[model samples]
Target chain A: MFSKILVANRGEIAVRIMRACRELGVATVAVYSEADRGALHVQVADEAVFIGPAPALESYLNMERLVEAAHHTGAEAIHPGYGFLAENPEFVRLCEEAGLVFIGPDSKAMALVGDKIRARQVVEEVGVPIIPGMKKSFPNLEDYRQAAQEIGYPVMIKASAGGGGKGMRIVYQEEDLLPALEAGQREAKAAFGDEAVYLEKYLEEPRHVEFQVLADHEGNIVHLFERECSIQRRHQKIVEETPSLALDDDLRFRMGEAAKKVMQAVGYTNAGTVEFLLDKDKNFYFLEVNARLQVEHPVTELTTGIDLVHQQIRIAAGQRLSFSQEEINQRGHALECRIYAEDPAKNFLPSSGRIIYLREPVGPGIRHDGGVYAGFEVPIYYDPILAKLITWGETRDQACARMKKALEDYVILGIKTTIPFLREVVQHPAFLEGKISTHFIPRYFSEWRPRPPSPEGQRLALIGAALREMKQGRERKRPTQLMSAGQDFLSPWQTLGPWRLGRRS
Target chain B: MNFEFMVDQKRIPVAIEKTSQGWEIDLGEAKVVVDAHWISENCVSLILEGKSYTLHVVPVDNGYLCYVQGELWSLGRPTQDLEYSQADQAGAVGDKLKVKAPMPGKVIKINVQEGEAVRENQTLAVVEAMKMENEIKAAQAGRVKKILVSVGELVDADRPLIELEEE
Candidate 1:
């Protein structure tokens, strides 16, 4: 194993990776941008390096700075946790050129999967089922119509350089194809300056399910299981769980095998996720590849009892597979809820501020991977994820119930969060019954509002507020864990409250 | 001590008196017995009539934000004791739409220029915070007078981005 590894990310994921390194007895280095100088990941690492300014382009995404930081810190390798430059092929190649092992797939494999069109062609050649679509964009309108008929109706015309849903249209029948194609091309020309458009079958009500795969240097590959992440807002997943309700044993095995096959074909190494869109008819189509440790990996870890970070490190250190595919088994069930610093009530707008108070939930069958502490000023320059609350149980219902109770126990004051909204999701009858799809959020919760507090609830809250109002003077700063661990006496922190917004009058 | 608060437009008047057992609280018509203790700076543990509940409350600006279960309730306002609110004061700045930011962030882009006519709901500027771009939109169709803040300028919550004269 490498003696020291540099974590090339921040937030909960960077902290999570360093924790795994500590367990393996490997010293870890953390790189931070200006906004994250006092971040949890920076404070916890064995060594820290300042990269650049708050803007990601000036820091985290700066490939040259990342490589230099690894070298200056004497880190043997760099672990791009997730986001930023994790899937950037140029960064992967830079690490390789600088002789610092990148704890993920090599640049060749990354480049192959990074290009959507090429990856689709490559995976299809390896017999992995792909979404039926045109391999390349066409300028002619008649060609799109012919391809749509072959691929069948309900086809989507998307710009080759599409983003932000621009230059995209879905047609259910032949009549809508020509006009839609012309509009898509015109929009594409005005938006991306690329009039070329591609055609593909659009699957309605498809669930976003993905498989976690691990590969060693010797080409040995195995899949842990599947995570159904259908609960998403604005194309970003918020809730994820393993052992998808939509998949039977036979279907699970097939999807798992297909995931491994895709990885094996590319000669990919380390931990990566192969995403699939499982449709209503039980058929699955390839979505894309996430070439790093996923945010929802804890669900896979809980079910399979495998440490993915440790495996990634070992694989980068040129180790062979320690176990076979048969040894891996999906245990009961595990669920993960991403606790982001965003308001769900106001169209899920991002909310940022100092964490005036924070209390993490704790108990058996519950694990919280948090990235911030009380008083940590959540910077306005990064991802809003503050933590992930994962729960395990012998059954899905048990996990669901545990998640609900744990969410109530979780307390993060000041900034708004998705806690109230998530609690409603886990308890929604349709979600509990496993009837969900990618449209789950829009279908069930577009007009959702936070339930009104009960009369008693309001009374207690107002009374609590009144007590603070009566407390003569106010303490301005945050309340801290001033008491040392295992202290017998009650410190002032336990008996006195400090942080208050101030009296209204 | 007597305190007044508002929740969703309803007025709540609470009176409290400290006692040896705990504190007795009077909610207008009814009186409730309670034992309350501060567990942390913003967390209070209260046992009301033999039932236990931990209420998380944080003092923010001129108001108190309280959390019960997953739901949040914000009490009071900047004009807590005043009968009229900022909403009523809006007429004072009438005929000019001051496009204010909803939160503190750096303005990454200005979508409109001075004297440009913009439709209602059209994006006026984009403020990037917490790695998300929040589009500041025009509430009514209007012509921009002048941009108040430059691109790349960091702004506080409610800082007006631009003033729009009615079009």
Candidate 2:
């Protein structure tokens, strides 16, 4: 194990990896941008270093600064958690050159899989089922239109170097292809610094299922079963679960085996996910490879009782597979809902502000992996995800019921979130029955919204507001507990950590 | 004490009194005597009409936001009417149309100048927030009266980016 590890990321994933490093008695060094001063991740780490300005391109995305920060902190390993530098093969190469262990696959493997078009060609050679599409990116819109003509209508446009739905669009007509392709290329360039993109046949109503795998340097790889991630909005998954209600035992085993084959073909290492889209007739096609620890790994952790972060760090440290495949048993069903700092009522626009209140759900089956505090500012320069809520139970019904209740119990103020939207999802009859697909949000919730607050609800809210005002008025007359709600400074309570957020005891 | 608050921009009245049994609150349509207890800082537990509920209140800009269950409503005092605070709220405010950035972000593109005609739903500008670009559109056919912000400048959640005089 490394004596020290530098987390080249920010927000919840950075905090999450730091927690794992703490558990392993490894010191964690956090690198932050100007926007992330006093962020929860900064406070939670053993040491902190300033990277650059708020723009991620100058800060988190700068490979040189991240490597320098790791060197300054004497970190032997760098854990690129999920977003910024996780899948960037160049960053991996830089870390290797700096003699710092990059806690993921080698640059060669990352480059091979990072290019989705190339991965498809290679996955096909291994005889794994894949969606039929263009073999390479086209030079112009006219070329793209011709390719789409061959693929038929309702084709999908995807960034060649994309994940997390940034550079992805579905066009059902030739008229929409040009604009959609241009937009995809632009987003891909902004997100991945790559303008290349390819086309694919849009699979209708396919359930998005992905398998988790762990491979070691000693060449041992094992599949950790599947996670059903069909619930999505804007092509990004919002809800996910393990032991998909869509798959039976026989089908699960085959998909799991196929997922291992896909990773094995690419020489994938550490922790990565193989996504597959299962059609209405139960036939599955390769979606893409998520070449990092995913945002929804907690769902798999609760069911399989394996700490994936621990495995990532250990694997990068040249540790062999600590356990065999037969020993890994998924005991129960698990579900995860991504909590984002966005308002669902207003097209899910990002809500950036200081969080004035936060109350995480807690119980025997609920888990919250959070990044924001009561007074922390959610910066506008990065992904809007604030946390993820996961729940586990003996049965799917038990898990679903717990998830709904936990959502109701979860409270966050000062910014809009998707708690209400996710609550509506788990309560839907189709969701409870597991009849979901990648188009679930559009098909079911195109115009779905929370019912207007009843008269009783309105009254209570107004009265509550009045009471708060009255309290404020009294405080103005006689200040107590340092009563000043007008400032955005860090209160003593925020510096006093482990109190506001419901950290796992 | 009588308090008038704007709930989602619609003003409503709330009156509270100290009664023999805890506090009595009047909400125009109904009157009830209730038990209110402080469960935590800014969090209240109330028992009214034989029903129990928990409400969380936090101070926001020129107002407070109260949350219960899945509902969150903002309460702003009518004393200082800063219309800019309503920037991210759906729909144009007070009939004077303004194209505002939905969230705080760096402005990437401005499609029109101070004196330019635009169609309803025209993409007036694009602001990148949280790494995703959001296009600000005109509510109706209008002429841009003022370009309040420039491209590549950072903006807040409700700051007006462009002022429009509608047809």
Candidate 3:
């Protein structure tokens, strides 16, 4: 076991990794940007280091700064918690060359699976079903149009260099193809700096299900079932769960086997996820593989009694697989709702401000992985995900009910959040029945306006506001009045029961 | 005594009468009981139907300082009457349309200049918040009359960012 490890990330995931490291008797070193000087993750780590400025390009993505921080702190290994620099193959190479263990798949494996185009080809070669599309690159409109005609209408133009719904477009007809391709290429160039794109046949209303796989240095790979990530908005996942309602015993087995095959082909190690798109007919096609830990890994952790991060660290330390395929079994249903600093009413745009008040839900089978406190200011530099509210129950319905209760119990002030939206989603009939897809939010609830507060309710609110104001006025007039009232242990309003002026009462 | 309370520019008249059991307050169409307990020299606790609400009072410039749910709100001397009335206006009568920001974020890029003609759904600006860039577009075909915000300026939800004149 390693004595110390460096966490090259921030936010809830960083805090999550730190807790796991402490439980495993390992010390953690946290790296932070200028904006995160007072961040929760920084305060929780055993050691902290200043990396760079607020912009990710200047700080979190600065591989040299991270490597130096690890070397300076004498960290034996570096754990890229998911996101910034987590899947960067170059960073893994740098860590390897510096003699510091990268706590994930090696640079070679990352390079193999990190490229979407290459990964698709490799997986298809291994008999994994892929979406019918072109594997070769489309350099111009002629090549794009030719491929589009062959792939049929409603083709998907996706960035070959990155994932996360960025640089992806869906064209429903020929007239929209060229413009979509152009826009997708532009976004891909701006986001990933590589304008490479590929074509894929669009499957209407497909559910996104991914398998969690872990391997060791000895080529042992085992999958921990699947997570259904169908509820999304603008290509970002909002809710996720394990043992998809779409997957039965036979289908689950087949998807699990396919995941293992992909992992074996890529010579994968540590913690990674193989994503698949499941159509209505239960036909699953291979999506790209994530080369690092995922944001929703906690759902799998709750269902399976395995510490994925601890396992990743151990695997990076050249340990052999501890559990066999037969030993791995999902005990119960688990679901996670990503609580973001966004307003669902406003197209889910990011919301940022100082948290003036926060009340997190707590009880049985409820887990909140958060990084912000009452006084923390959520900066606008990074992702707006404040925390992930996950709940586990004996069954799927029970888990959904628990998630709904947990969301209601959660409260945050000083900025608008998607709490109201998440509350509605968990209570949605389609979501409850596990009948969802990528278009769930935009298709059904896109125009679902928040119902206005009724006039009677508003009148009640006004009365309450007025009463509060009057009490405040009296207290201000005589500060000693409050002091004396405090001594009496009676409310000032109660003492002065009925004082009257006039009118309509 | 009957005192009328105005909140968020709306007047709410409440009637309070002393009773042997407690205080009976007529709040519009409902009658309820009020239980107040002094929490400190600056705060009081109000309990209603098993739920407790704490109120913090302090002195402000022209009125009293109030804190509800940890948020500081001000209550000044009653001046203007609180009323909600519909405004009668005409459509497309050479009036400048206010373009309020859809959400709180820092303006990243401004793609249009003042006096430039823009079509509906045309990109006007990009607001970068929460690590994603949201492109703000023109709601209707119009000419840009004024740009109220600049790049890198942090804005709140519904804050005016631009003004558009009918084409």
Candidate 4:
């Protein structure tokens, strides 16, 4: 086992990986940008180093800076959490050249699967089902339109280098293809710095299901069942659950095997997710592959009682698979809701501000992987996800019930969040019946607005307001001038000078 | 004490009195008792009508930004004449108003000058933040009265950009 590892990411995933490393009796080194010097991940890690400025290009995304940080801290290995440099094959190769163990698949498998078009070909060669579409990138909008016509109407134009739904568009008519293609290419170039795009037949109302696959360097591979992630907005998943209501045991077994086949075909190691789109008839097609630990891995952990990060480290250390396929079973149902710092009504645009207050939900079956705390400034330099709220129960209904309650218990102020929107989604009757598809949000919540507070809620607000007045009035009468509300706006690092770091108990 | 507050921009009259168990509040249509305990300077644990709730209250310039049941409400003492906030008055962006940067970023470009005519949804300026360039659009058919910002200048969130007079 490695004595120390450097986490090449920030936010909740970085903290999450550090926690796993601590549990395994390993030291963790965290790299942070100037904006993140006092971030939760920095505070949580065993050691910390300054990487660069706030912009990711000069900081988290800078492979050289990360390698230098690892070398300086004497970290034997580097773990790239989900975002930032996680899936960048160049970063992996750089780490390897530096003689550091990259806790993910080797660059060879990454290059082969990281590109959406190449993965489709690889999966197709292995007899795994894939979406019927172009295997090559379309050079122009006219070529894209012709491909869409051949594939029939209602086709999806997607960026070849895209993930997270940034460079994806669905067009129902040939006339709209040109604009949609242009938009997709533009977004792809801006978000991923790649303008290449491909066309595919758009399946109406398909459920997005993916399988979690883990492999060791010795070629041993296993699939951790499936997670249904049909609840999304703007092509990004917000809600996910395990043991999809749409899949039966037979289908689950088949998909699990197929997921493993794709991994084996690429000689892949470490942890990855093989995504598929399931249609109404139970037929599934390969979507793409996520080449790192996913944001929703906690759902799988809750259902199977396995810590995926631990397994990833073990595999990266060249260890054999400790458990076989027969050992993994879905003992219960789990659900996860991503808490984002955005307003659902205004097209989910990212919102940035200090978190004036934060109360994470806690109890039996509730797990919150949060990145920020009260007084933490959610910067505009990165992803808007603040935390992921997950709940597990013996049955699906129990899990849903707990999820609704947990959402209610969760409180965050000073910025708009998607909690209310997610709560409505889980409580919707269609969601309870497991009849959701990728188009669920647009189909059901096209005109969704944050419902106004009820009369009871108004009464509560009034009481809260009155209490605020009383408190302020009392504070005004006191001789001390401490505890100003403005204090919440200042970063602790700014107020406390540099932070003093020591090993946390 | 009796007070009037603007809830979601609508004025509501509320009456409050301290009771042994909690506080009694009377809205026009009904009355309810709320038990509230201050958890912090801005957070309160409340039980209203026998249901538990927690509220986060932040003080704004003329109001308290209260969060209740996943909704944010700006609560403030009603103005003597019930003057509308800039948003309420600027709704539909008619004769005169200033276009503000919704969120802070660098001003990449300004498409209109101080006396240019513009149509609704026309790109007035572009601000880049979080690596995405957002085009600030005109809300109504108007002529630009003043350009408050210049290209390449960094602006804070919600800072006014261009003033417009409806054409």
Candidate 5:
């Protein structure tokens, strides 16, 4: 076991990985940008390093600086926690060249599976059904149109470089193709710095289900079932759960086998996920493979009783399979809600400010992996996710109910958040029935406006207002004047006093 | 004292009074005891029915700075009657207007310039906030008055950015 490891990421994920390292009796070194000097993860880690300025390009995404920090600190391995340099193949290669283990899959596997088009082609060769679309990048508008025609209308144009819904668009007609393509390319270039894109058949109301696969360096692999990640906004998943309600025993087995086959095809090692799209008719198709730890890995961990991060570390340390596929048993259902500092009312635009106050939900089956604290400023230079709220229960419904209650108990002030919107989504009819898709938010909530407060609430507001006025009035009056006014029965508190009636009762 | 309050959009009546223990509140539907302590000139900590709530009350120019559970909620006071005087001046020519930023953000791009004609929904500027770019659009058809913010300038929300004259 390594004595110490460096976490080359920030926010809740860094805190999450540090916790795992602690339990495994390992010390952690955290790297942070200037904006994150006082962040929770930075404060909790055993040691901290100042990476760079606030912008990720000069900080978290700077691979050379991160490696240099690891070397200077004498760290044995570097854990790229999910985002940033997590799946960067070149970073893995650099880490290897430095004689430090990269706590994820090898560079070759990441390169083969990180590319969406190539991943799809490999999965199809393994006999896993894939979405009907082009295997090669379209050269021009005419090629794109021809591909879309063959795939039928309502085709999806997606960036071949990265995921997380960036640079992905659905075109309903030929007229919308050019603009959508241009916007997709522009967003892709800005987000991934790669303009390559491919076309695919867009499945309407398709549930997003993904299988979690864990493999040892020795080529032993197993799948940890599926997670339903259909609840999304703008193509980004907001909520996720394990044991998808949409999958039956047979379908689950089939999908799991297919995912295993895809992993095997790439000679995949360490923890990775194979994502798929499940249509209403129960047909499943390969979406892509995330060749690193995922944002929603907690759900799978809660269900399968597996510490995925621990497994990743062990595999990177040259450990073999700890458990066989048949030995792995899944327990109850688990759900995770991503709390972001974004205004759902304003189309989920990112909001940033100092966190004046925070109250995290606590109780049985509730887990909060958060990165911010009261007085910490939420910077505008990175992703807006504040925390991941996860809950586990004996059943799916119980887990959902617990998650809803937990969300209500959770509160953060001084910034807009998606908490209110997520509350509505968890209680939504379609969400309760596990019937959701990428279009869930836009389809159900696009025209739905939040109703105003009720009359009883108004009365409370009036009381609140009167209280304010009285407080102000007392402030304006001198002590002698306030004493003189207190002697009068016409005083605001004396005139319509409920205390007087209560004494009579 | 009896008070009318609006919750959501409905109006409700409430009554409250001091007691030996603390204070009592009646909502016609139920009665509850509350212990209130003044934390600051504009803030109070209240415990009602076993639940704790902190309220911050600041006197804004027009209304109240009502902070509840750490959130700054706005409470508008009912308007008072005042005498109104109508202006008789008309046919005044409009000159170049200066536009200010509505919100504080770093300007990512400028789409238009001074004396440029813009239609409604036309993108005039892009402001990057929390790592996402928000395109500021023209509210109505008008000719450019004046652009005040340049790319990379940080601006506050609701600050005017451009002045426009009717085309």
Candidate 6:
């Protein structure tokens, strides 16, 4: 095993990778931008290196700086924890050139799968089902229109190198196709520096499910069950759960086999995820392959008792697979709610401020992978995700109930968050019954408002607030000017009962 | 002590008087006892009708922002008549529109120059925050009078980005 590994990312996932390395008795190095001098990931690592300025283009996404940081720290391997350069095939090649092992699949497999169009072709060649769409990117408007017509209307224009909903659009008619194609190309060039995009047949009311696949360097591969991630807003997943209600035992087995076959076909190694879109009739089609550890990997980890990061490290060190597919069983159910620093009421606009108060939930079957402390200032230059609240139980209902209770116990103040909105989602009857699609947020909660407090609760809050001011004012006053009994309405001697003041307040 | 409490934009006038037993709060016909004890700097324990409630309070400019039972209330001693002003709530009025940022972020691009005519929904500036670029658009057709911020400047939420003169 490598004595030291460098984490080339920031936020919760960086900290997560370092934690796994530390447990394996390996020292870890953290690379940070100027804006992340006091970031949690830097504080947790054994060594830290300043990469560049605040912008991701100059820091996290700069492959030269990342390799230099690893070389400077003498890190034997580099773990690009999701986002940034995690799935960049060029970054993997650079790591290889610098004599450092990239803790993911080789660059050959990544190049084959990173391009969405090429991925569709490869999966289809291996007898895996893919959505009926263009085999390659369109060159011009006429070509795109022809492909859209062949695939029928209501097709999707997606960037070949895009994720997280950027550089993508859904066109419902020919009139919308030109504007969407132009917009898609512009966004793709801005986001990925590539103007290549392809068409995909849009499936209405399809549930987003994905299978986790882990492969070792010695041609051994296994597949974990599936996670239902249909709860989304603006094409980004907000909530995820394992052992989807839409998949029965038979369907789950088939998806698992299909995932393993795809990975095996690509000579894939380390941990990766194969996403699928499950339609209303229980038929599933391959969506794309995420060639790195996912943000929602914890949901799969908790269910199968598999430490994916540790496995990734082992595979990079040329280790054989420790467990077979039959041994990996999905036990119990796990749900994950991504707690972001955004206001759901304001079109999910991201908000940034210092965290004044934070109370993480704690109990059996509960885990909170948080990245910020009470006094940490959430920066405006990165993702808005602050933490992930995960819960587990013997049954899906039990897990849902635990997740709802855990959300109530979680508290974060001084900035807007999606906690209240997430609580509403988990408690909704449709969600509990597993009748959800990617349009869950828009169809059911487009104009949802927070549940108002009871009238009695409001009255009590005002009274308490008024008294709080009075108490603070009196404490700041001079001792000699302290009010006597019956002098003012805010006199402590009059407001405090004798019996209650004796005990702890 | 007399104060006005703002809850969801509705202001309620409350009056309190010291009594032999506890503080009596008068809100029109309803009277309640509020026995408050200071627990810490930002926390207070209050008892009303034998039920205890713990409240978190943060002192703001001229008022107290308190949280109780997952509800937020702002209590302030009305400086004067406490009339609600829509000007503070909305950014602009009449023909002119004040383009403001939806959230705190750094300005990355200024698309329009001062004195340039812009149509409704035309991109005026791009502010990048939370790793996403949001374009600030013109709400109404007008000529830009002043650009309040430059590129790479950090701005707070609702801070004016550009001021438009009625065209």
In order of appearance, the predictions have TM-scores of 0.86, 0.92, 0.84, 0.89, 0.83, 0.87
The predictions' CA RMSDs to the true structure, in order, are: 7.1, 3.8, 9.3, 3.9, 10.0, 7.8
The alpha-carbon lDDT assigned to residue A355 of candidate 4 equals 79
> Would you list the clashing residue pairs of candidate 1?
A498-B41, A500-B59, A501-B59, A501-B60
- As for lDDT, the candidate ahead, 3 or 5, is 3
Model 2 DockQ class = medium
Model 4: per-residue lDDT, tens digit, A202-285? 898899999999999887899999999999887889999998999999999999999999988886899999999999899999
Output the TM-score of candidate 3. Answer: 0.84
Q: Scoring model 1 with DockQ, what do you get?
A: 0.43
Residues A310-379 of candidate 6: C-alpha lDDT, one tens digit per residue? 9999999999988998898999999999999998777778889876655577898998887776567888
Write model 4 residue lDDT over B1-167, tens digit each, in one string.
77788876678888777888777778787777878887766777877767777788887668787878766677877883256565556664542367888886778778888899999888899876655556789877888999999997878876889998866
Q: List the residue pairs that clash in candidate 3.
A: A499-B1, A500-B1
Provide the lowest-lDDT 10-residue window in model 6 chain A: A485-494
lDDT of 1 by residue, A1-505 (tens): 8999999999999989988887787888999989888787887788899999987778888889999999998999999988777877788899999999999999999877765567788899988888988887665778877899999988877655433244577899999898678766755554334566788778889999999999988878889989999887766788999889999999999999999989887778899999899888988998778888999999999999998998999999999979999999988899999999988877777788887767788898999898887767888777788999999999999999999999988878778889989989999999999888988999999999878678767877788888877752433253654532122122232223222245232
iRMSD of all candidate structures: 5.7, 2.5, 7.8, 2.7, 8.3, 6.7
Error of 5 at B116 (Å): 3.7
Which segments of model 5 are wrong by more than 4 Å?
A: A138-150, A458-505, B1-18, B24-105
Candidate 2 chain A: worst-modelled 10 consecutive residues by lDDT = A485-494
DockQ of each: 0.43, 0.57, 0.27, 0.46, 0.22, 0.43
lDDT of candidate 5 over A1-505, digit per residue (tens): 8988999988889888887887787778999999898777787777889999877778998889999999888899999987677777888899999999999888888888777778888888888899989988866868898888999989999987777776888899999898778768866665555778989998988999999999997779999999999888778889999988888889999999999999999878989999999998999998988888899999989988999999988888888978898988889999999999887766677778776555678899998888777567888777788999999999989999999988877757667788878878889998888777777888887875544545534433444566766666666785543322112212232133222223331
Candidate 2 per-residue lDDT, tens place, A1-505, comes to: 8999999999889989988998887888999999999688888887899999988889999999989999898999999999777889899999989999999999999998998889999999999899989988878778999999999989988988868888888999988888788778877877877888899999888999999999999889998999999999989999999999889989999998889898899999999999999999999999889999999999999999999999999999999998998889988899999999998889999999878888888898999888887777888989999999999999999999999999999888878899999999999999998888888899999998767887666788888888887777777787456634322234343365433245443
Q: TM-score, chain A, per candidate?
A: 0.85, 0.95, 0.89, 0.93, 0.89, 0.91
Task: Provide the DockQ value for model 5.
Answer: 0.22
Q: In terms of lDDT, which candidate is stronger, 2 or 3?
A: 2
lDDT, candidate 3, A1-505, per-residue tens: 9989999989999988987887777888999999999887887787899999887778888899999999999999999987777777888999999999999899998988877778888998999998888877766778989899999988898877667666788888888887678667765654455678888898898999999999888878899999999998877898999979898899999999999999999989899999999998889999889888899998999999898988888888888988899998898899999989987777777778776556677898999888887567899888888999999999999999999888877767556688878888889998888779888988878887655545544433433444545565666787465243122223232233223245133
Residue pairs with colliding backbones in model 4 are none
Per-residue error (Å), model 6, residue B104: 2.5
Model 3 segments more than 4 A misplaced: A136-142, A174-195, A454-505, B1-9, B14-25, B35-100, B104-109, B113-115, B145-163
Model 6 Cα shift for residue B162 (angstroms): 4.0
Residue A146, candidate 4: Cα error in Å is 3.7
